[model samples]
Target: MLTFQPAKPNQLDAIMTIENQGFTPDEAATKPSMAERIDRISDTFIVASQDQQVLGYVVGPASDERYLSDNLYDHLTANNPADRYQTVLSLAVAKDARDQHIGSQLLAELAKVARAQNRTTITLTCLKKLVPFYERNGYVNEGVSDSAHAGETWYNMVKTL
Candidate 1:
């Protein structure tokens, strides 16, 4: 069985393992940055584990705007929990766990939590090719994103709760 739970700071290495595998060096967050996020806003960070080993995870934070800004990724700060939208920073599934539905399950749970907290939307940015994946899971593509992270073009996607 898979167990999903709130991420803890001590599990930084585990989360990074997946992050490194899923993203490029420029796109992947540094250890300190990722740790700070897990430390500062763990309520929005979750992990997927089986037999006590983390296999995937999702990290998000509340934002005042509907779309994610470049600054948010550079500096994750304290936020207004009452914000209308939840900005998902990243979702990673280990290489070995790619074919499984763990990523979808994490997104689903995050949506449920966001709705319960009165968040109107859950937003994310992904490469153009991955837009359909998010769409299949209920997110709407809002056209090209302003982000040029890792020199890769991305698109804005959102799921209205």
Candidate 2:
């Protein structure tokens, strides 16, 4: 059976292992980056495992500068309590674990955390190729972006909770 748990300190290494394997070098979060995000958003971070073997994880900052309601970063760090909404910084599954709904489960768990925190939305930026996938899973495509990985086009998506 698959079980979900809050990511632990030691598990950051394993999470990085899967991330490095799934994304391009620059796209993957380095250990220190993951550690920093963990420090900021541990309550919103989670890992999925079966038989104690890591399969996937979803994590992000507890709050970010970008706001979907206006699609702009706050110029001076204004607090939009909604800004505390967790941004899904990373979502990755093991190579052998694709097509198994692990990503969806991770998303559901993340949503739960958001709701518990009184966050009103869940947001993410995805590559063009991933737009449809996120749409099929209930996220809305908001706009295009110049921040694509490896020069690919990116789409901003969000789901209101």
Q: What tens-digit string does per-residue lDDT give for candidate 2 at 1-161?
A: 98998888878887888999888886676787777656656777789999988899997654554433222221112223555566776899998888999999999999998888787778888777888878888999889854645555667788888
Using lDDT as the measure, which candidate wins? 1
Lowest lDDT block of 10, candidate 2: 69-78
Query: How accurate locally is residue 126 in candidate 1, as Cα lDDT from 0 to 100?
Result: 94
Candidate 1, residues 117-143: lDDT per residue as tens digits? Answer: 789999999998789889999999999
lDDT value for model 1? 0.89
Model 2 TM-score relative to the real fold: 0.84
The top-ranked prediction according to TM-score is 1
Runs off by more than 4 Å, candidate 2: 64-84, 146-151
- lDDT of each prediction vs. the true structure? 0.89, 0.74
